[model samples]
Target chain A: MIEFSNWDILRNLLLAAQWTLLLSIAAFIGGTVVALTLTAMRLTRNVVVMRIVRVYVELFQGTPLLMQMFLCFFGLSMIGYEISAWGAAILSLTLFTSAFLVEIWRGCIDTLPKGQWEASRVLGLNFLQTLRHVILPQATKVAFAPTVGFSVQVVKGTALASVIGFVELTKAGTMLNNATFEPFKVFAFVALIYFALCYPLSLCSKYLEKKYHVAR
Target chain B: MSLVKLDQVHKYYGDFHVLKGIDLNIKVGEVVSIIGKSGSGKSTLLRCINGLEAYQQGGIAVDDKEVTSEDIQVRRLALSVGMIFQSFNLFPHLTVGENIMLAPTIVLKKSKQEAEKTARAMLEKVGLGDKFDRYPEKLSGGQQQRVAIARALAMNPKVLLCDEITSALDPELVGDVLKVLEQLAAEGMTLILVTHEMNFARDVGDRVVFMHQGKVWEEGNSKKLLSEPQTEELKQFIGAVL
Candidate 1:
């Protein structure tokens, strides 16, 4: 067995963490755009559009995300099309994150009192116009804390990308453990790295919840 | 032409009929008060005039445009009819001035400067000139309701619907709101109100209508309705109020 050096392990984990951060950011921004689109589609009155969004939500929510990543990465390659592991991981995470975000956002919209809708409608705003002016501004306050809290989940979710040949902190830790034959130490270091990234965001989310009472 | 006319208007909430074969006409600048017990479809009638609630079978015309279209003529009718709810329903996210200016700027397509000027003038009229920057939650219930009234009035609607506007206020706060509404009525704003304030109904309403069991039971000048109600239900309602 190779001798494990703590400094080398720390250095590798830190370098790999940059990719984890980048991946999470990529997934979050892409997911927000898609989630907003899904929210609009879900809010529409057309039965066919609503049914399509419902199926999209159910399919993404019901399937295991790890299987989704595997299918997106290797399954696509099997059809004579080669895509990088990074592309596949980002695509899968984007789709998964958006599905969950859309559901969370739709709940925020639904939480709005019926009176606001009636008030805006009486003001002669169409559905989209109402959303842009009245409903969304109020809903944003409700959506804020929970959305920040959900980012913590996304940061943790980056670990699953390691299974698809992506070189994130978790993947790096696995490689380091195999070479050094020290699972406990490597895993503990990996956990610390994640804590360092996630703890501040969790604190910020709690602070927002207190200040805004977003859940209420 | 009368500002509003409803003919054989029928509204239902899953077979529990709310408005049954109702016929009414209100000329411009008329202040009509509808008094009824709770769940007597008084609020429903006010809502139907603005198309806020869909009636199963009816024809409501606001300023002579048919309101029973599939596309729904909300914008045109809304420009002519403004509604104030029991709960103020001010957009909490917006400031008082912003709340008042929103419809003018958006629905009426007025410029920001014009809308803001109109909003400030209206707020001054409502005795809230200094409260323009405040959020709705920062205002008292009466103050917020005044802002709501100001918001609707900025649209320059020909008809104003007040649905139990003072029901949520404290007794002390009710006077201030009624004063503002009284001022609006005195200025010749065509007003339709569903109210529990019997004295205000008798004093301020030009016409008093008693809706009972989903139809207008008795209606005439407020003096006649208050002193000599024709139906047993109206007498019982007035007896309870007095």
Candidate 2:
């Protein structure tokens, strides 16, 4: 058996944590783009398109994130599409994050008074202008706390990506345990690193909750 | 020719009939007050004229442009018509002047300096010249309602629709808003109001429309119509509100 020191284990885990951070950043940005597009599409007030988005939100939110990873990784490959583990991980995480995020944004937009929309529309502002000036400014205030809080879930959700052979914090922890036979230390560091990554987000949410005081 | 016209307008919410064939016309520089019971279509009628509330059947024309559900047509028609609401729907996020300047700057494509000048002028008309920098939430309900009026006026619409503009104000605050409307009427700005102020309708209104069950039951000179109730519905409406 190879004799791996504590520093060696820590270094390897730290290296893997970089991938974890990278994946999280990519997923969050991708999720934001997808969620914003979906929100705009829903605002058109078209029945068929709205139903399609509803089913999408329901489909992603109803199923497990882990299952989504498996489908993106193994299932797509089984059907003859060449998908790398990194690509699969990012794709599944993006979908998962956006499904919840689009709904969260919709709720924030809904919290506004209907008169806001009507007032802008009656003033001869088009739908896009109404969003740009009136609706989004107010909705963003109410959306901040919940949106930051949800990012913590996205960070944690990256852990599930390790199951599909993406060597993130959790995957590194498991591989190190097999090599060193010290499960407690490796797993504890994994948990600690995740805590380090996610705790700031939780604090940020709390700070925003207090700062904005959300007078809606 | 009438400045605003509604011929056989009908609206429905699902299966429930809300506006059942309303026909009305008003000349330029006229102030028409529409009064009715809660479920009556007076407010709905005013909304239909401005294309805020869509009607399934019938035609409405403001300044000869037809009102429809198409976004472009709605926006085009909105250029000629302005409306205020019962709840004083001022944008709380923007300062008083910004709220008034928004439509003019963006939709009407006025330059920023030009928009600001229009905003200042409209606020002055509403007696809030000094309140241009204040936010809507910081002002009292009456002040906010006045800001809403200023916002509508900034568009320079040919006709203004008031949907119970004073309904949400304090009893003391209602007079200030009504006073602003009186000034508009005096300036011959062409105003249509949905109101419960019998005294205001008679005192300042050029004509009064009494709506019952989605139809104009009785309408005549404001003073004569309110003083002599021709229909039992109008008599009952007056008896109840007064």
Candidate 3:
């Protein structure tokens, strides 16, 4: 067996944590773009477009993210497009994150008073203009806390990417455990690293919730 | 020439008729007040004039342009017909000046400086010039309602429709909002209001229209209508409220 020093394990895990962080950021930004489009489509009065978005949301949200990752990584290969593990992880996580974010943001938009829509319409603003100028400004305040809170979920979700062969923090911890013959110590360190990443985000969400509570 | 004309206008909410066969006309600078019991359709008639609620039958013409469901026509009508609500629907997120300036800058395509100038002027007109930079939540109910008025006037509407503008204010606060309306009337801005304040209606309105069960039941000189009721329904309404 190879002798693994504590510093070596930590140093290697720390190096792998960078991949986890990068994946989380990628999922968040990509998810946000797709979610915004989905939200706009959902808001449209078109029945077909709304139904299509609804089906997309349900397909992503109702299934396991792990299953989605498997489909992206292995199922795509079956169809003859051998996607890289990195690409598959991002694609699956983005779809997963967007499904949730769109629902959360749509709830925010729904919370606004109906008078807001009427008032903006009476002011001669079109649907898009009304959304940009009036509805979104208010919805953003309502959405901010919940949105930040959900980021913690995204960060945690990156751990699941390991099953598809992406060498993130969890994967690194598993490799470290195999080499060190110390599962408890290796996993404890991994958990600590995740805590370090997620705790501050949790605090930020709480702060925002407190700040905007009076307005609600 | 009449600035607003509603000809046999009818509105329904899923077979429940809310406004039934209403004909009304207002000349430039006229101040008309509508009063009725709850569910009397006073608010519905006012909303139809601004295209906030579409009438199922008949026609509404503001500034000689017919109001239609077409987006551009509705928007054009909106330019000439401003509306204020009882709830004072000022955007809570924006400051008073921004609330007032929003339409002018976006819809009218006015420059920021020009819109700000107009917003400040309207705020001053409503006696809340000092509150321009403040958010709606910071203001009292009366002050917020005044900001809503200023927001509407920023469009330079030829006619203003006010649906129970003072109904949501605290008792002491109602006077301040009504006083602003009185000032607007004195300046010859054509105003139509649905109000619960019988005294303000008598004092400020050129005509008081009594609406009952989705129709204009009776109307005449404001003082005459209040002092001498011709219909039994009007008599009961006056007795109940006053």
Error of 3 at B194 (Å): 1.1
DockQ values, each candidate: 0.65, 0.81, 0.73
Sorted by DockQ, highest first, which candidate order results? 2, 3, 1
Worst 10 residues of 1 chain B by lDDT: B68-77
lDDT of 3 by residue, A52-80 (tens): 99999999999999999999999999999
Range of the 10 consecutive residues with the lowest summed lDDT in candidate 3 chain A: A207-216
The TM-score of candidate 3 is 0.95
- Candidate 2 has a DockQ of 0.81
Which CAPRI tier for candidate 2? Answer: high
Best by DockQ: 2
The better candidate by lDDT, 1 or 2, is 2
TM-score, prediction 1: 0.96
The stretch of ten residues in a row with the least summed lDDT in candidate 2 chain B is B44-53
Q: What is the per-residue lDDT of model 1 for residues A99-181, given as tens digits with 9 covering 90 to 100?
A: 89999999999998898988877777777778899999889888888898999888998899999889999999999998988
CAPRI-style docking class of model 3 based on DockQ: medium
**Which regions of candidate 3 are displaced past 4 Å?**
A214-216
Candidate 2 ranges with C-alpha deviation above 4 Å: A1-8, A214-216
On the 0 to 100 scale, the lDDT of residue B209 in model 3 is 92
